[model samples]
Target: VIDIFNNFALGICEGQQLDMDFESKTSVSREEYLRMIELKTSVLLKGALQIGAVLGGANEKDIENIGEFGRCLGLAFQLQDDLLDTYGNVDVFGKNIGGDIVAGKKTILTIETISLLGLKAEIFVELLQNKTLSRYTKVNDVIKIYDQVGVKQIAEALIEEYFKRAYDSLMKISVPDERKVVLIEIAQNLMNRQN
Candidate 1:
């Protein structure tokens, strides 16, 4: 328990540090972004499930499976969050859209767009970094660039991949099939959510 807590705290701190470090850079690779999110977001979910399984007297294998499930789910959730921040309906999502772009956050969409656009990515980055532009205008400009590069499709595919991984992990758990149904439903709902 102590070790889990210690590692969890360390992971969160490391993730935060990486996020801060990435902010100063013009671009971050997909691998670096994934590692950061795994530490910042997924570690908390992984630690929670592992600790719960321990308290519930789960065997080692079950613990491992549940932890995998948590990690994959966390990744999928963050991907969805990135999507929602850009494309979700403001009313349904209950937040301002394109907040990520306005803040110049480096998400899968941004990273992929950067890679795909080659030299053209500079224009998009410039729009994101321009403080003089209105938030609405900046978001619209960025979205236009993303649309041209098919970033939405790419990001959706990646999100689905993570979702499938989460499901596969859940299936490996030793629990009864019925016991897993609720979790499956929850994952589906999260994936389908507009907010």
Candidate 2:
């Protein structure tokens, strides 16, 4: 149990620090951000799937294949989480929407768009820090930033990367397509999900 916790801890810490560094306007290259995401989130999901497949009597090849599939889905899942934290309903989610924005946690969309948006980034960053600003104003300011930096488009592209990897992994599994199709459908549905 300790090892399991330890294995997970490293990635979780990396993810948290990555978000903090990104959001606080600290320096982070795009490569550094992706590396952090893959380590913190996707690695755990991949491990779980691999261990389950092995314990269930799957061959090494099959386990490896499923692990890759899980990795792709996990990446997409984390990215969707970032999107939701920005755009989803707070009441239903049971957390403050755009907490990430206020915290300045660097996500893929945020990191990617900052350079593209130029001076507007500075304005939005300031607005995010203005304690007197209303929630409505704060949200609108973020939306404007999103529009300027093309966050929506960037999200779509990142999700597409996950989907493509997932597809290839599904195709690699030696199991019947009928048995594997369910997982593929799950991946597809996750990619399209809004909440």
Candidate 3:
């Protein structure tokens, strides 16, 4: 428990630092963004699961499985959060959308869009930097570029992939099928949630 808490605390701090660093960067790779999210968000979830498994008298292998499952689920959750910030309905999403674009946050969607757009990404970056532009215009224009490159689809696909990997890890645990049912249902609900 002590070690888990320590690691979790350190991971969050490091992740936050990386996030700040990415803010000034012109371009951030998908891999780098994923790593940042994993450190910032996944580590806490992973540590909790690992600690729970240890308390439950799980073997080392089961603990590892739980960690992997939590890690993947955390990644999926963060991706979904990023998606919601841009694409979700304001009423259901419970917050103003497109905040990421306005803030110029380096989400997976933006990273992929920039990568696909190549040199043309400069135009998108300019839109983000243009202080005179209204919030509506900036967000609308960025979303247009995102839609042009099918970034939402790409993000959704990545989320599905992570969920699948998480499920695979969950299945490797030694628990009986009945014991796993609740977890499976929770995972499904998480994937389908609007907020």
Candidate 4:
């Protein structure tokens, strides 16, 4: 238990540090972004499931499978969160849209938008980094760039990939098929949620 908790904490800290480090850079590769999220977001879920499996007397194989499920689900969840923060309806999403844009957070959408835009990415990044721009204006400009570059579709596809991975991990577990139904439903609901 102590080991799990300690490692989880360290992983989260490392992920956050990477996030901060990425903020100053002009661009981040997709692989690097995934690694950061896996450490920062996935570790929490992985640790929780591993700890739970241990308490439940799950064998080593089951523990590994459950941890994989949790890790994949965590990635899916974070991707959805990134999508919602950019594209979701304010009323349904229960938070202001484009918060990530306002904060200049380098999400997958941002990276893709920059990569697709080439020279024009400088303008988009400027708008994001500009302290003088109103929040509404900054978010609006960034969203416009994202739309022009088809980032929403790209992000949705990536989210789907993670969802598929989560399902694959769940399938590898030795539990009866019926026992996995609730987990499947939860994953579906999470992927399909508006908020």
Candidate 5:
């Protein structure tokens, strides 16, 4: 348990460093972003599950399954958060939309759009880099580019992929199907969440 906690702490520190480093970077790969999130978000969730499984006296295989499930869930959750930052309703999501856009956060949407647009991405990049643009205009413009490149659909597809992997991991646990109901319900709710 102590070791799990220590590992989680170290992973979080490293992930945060990577996240900060990516901010000024001109290029960031999808894999690198995924790895950063895995360390930043997934490791904490995985540690919690692993500690719980250990306390519950689960076998090593069951612990491993739980860890995988937690890791994937964390990834999907963070992706959903990124999507909500731009697309969610302010009333429902309890925050102003387009925070990520205004801050020039390199979410999956922007990263993929950069890759897909190539030379065409210059306009999009310019919009983000412009210091004088109004917040609403910048966000709306960036969102337009995102729509043109189908970035939302791409992000949704990736989120679904992670959720599916989480489900698979949950199913592999040794517990009976009935015992997995709560976890399944929670995951389903998370997948469908709007806020």
Candidate 6:
């Protein structure tokens, strides 16, 4: 059990990678983003809860439920990140900021835009890649691609799924209320912030 638990524990990062795939703005679609998020973030979050319950001596059934709960929670956390990266202020981002969505390469928003824009995307990419182009144009052209493809709505939907998944995970855990209180607070405080 511990071995399975360990493998799953590390597997959690897979979902994060999937989310990264979306954010990278490569060539993803809205549905594709969902699949990645579910696999990467949801699975790992679920695995973590199950691992905890197993170590805590919870029953098998409860472990399974807790795993689901964890998955949902993870989804929520991830979605919140997605939102911040898109709409949050660049000033707060600390480093170079445009909300990850602006880069319009492989991010969830980019995927949506590319799907809609089609071949024009090639020209867009060329302009985006141009060393001579100003950063403002790069951002502008990329956002144009997003607008062409309906990225904003698509990203919004994806964000909602992660939040729902988080709630599902929270509901399934078997731990006492006290044990969960801190976790809930963490979810509330950390899930959507830019820091």
lDDT tens per residue, model 2, 1-195: 345346656877887777566555544666787777877788787777777776778888987888888778888788888877887777665677777676656777676776576665666556656777777677678777787668878887887888799789878988788988778788877887766
Superposing every Cα of model 5 onto the true structure, what RMSD results? Answer: 0.9
* Candidate 5 wrong stretches, greater than 4 Å: none
The root-mean-square deviation over C-alpha atoms between each candidate and the true structure, in angstroms, is 1.2, 3.1, 0.9, 1.5, 0.9, 4.0
Report the lDDT tens digits of candidate 3 across residue range 82-152. 99999999999998999998888999988999999998888887887888988999999999999999999
Q: In candidate 1, which residue ranges exceed 4 Å CA deviation? A: none
Give per-residue CA lDDT, model 1, range 1-195, as digits (tens). 778778888999999999999999988999999899999998898888889888989889988888888888888888889989999999999999999998889998899999998988787787778999998898998998889989999889988998899899889988899988987998899889999
lDDT over C-alpha atoms for residue 13 of model 6: 68
Candidate 2 at 97: error in angstroms?
Answer: 3.5
lDDT of 6 by residue, 1-195 (tens): 676566665665675676565544546666666567667666766766677677889887777777766666665566556655655667785555443533443555555555666777677556545667566666666666666666767666765665566555665666677877876776666555674
lDDT of each: 0.90, 0.74, 0.92, 0.89, 0.92, 0.62
Show where candidate 6 strays beyond 4 Å.
9-26, 31-44, 99-105, 118-120, 127-131, 147-150, 174-179
For candidate 3, what is the total of clashing residue pairs?
Answer: 0
Per-residue lDDT, model 5, residue 159, is: 98
Instruction: Please identify which of the two predictions, 1 or 3, would achieve the higher TM-score against the true structure.
Output: 3
lDDT of 5: 0.92
Model 5 lDDT tens row, 1-195? 899889989999999999999889887889999999999999999999999999999999999999999999999999999999999999999989999888988898889999999988788788888879999989898998989999999999999999999999999999899999999999999999989
| Model 4 poorest ten-residue lDDT run | 119-128
Alpha-carbon lDDT of model 2: 0.74
TM-score of every prediction relative to native:
0.95, 0.80, 0.97, 0.93, 0.97, 0.70
Candidate 4 residue 163 Cα shift, in angstroms, is: 0.7
CA lDDT for candidate 4 = 0.89
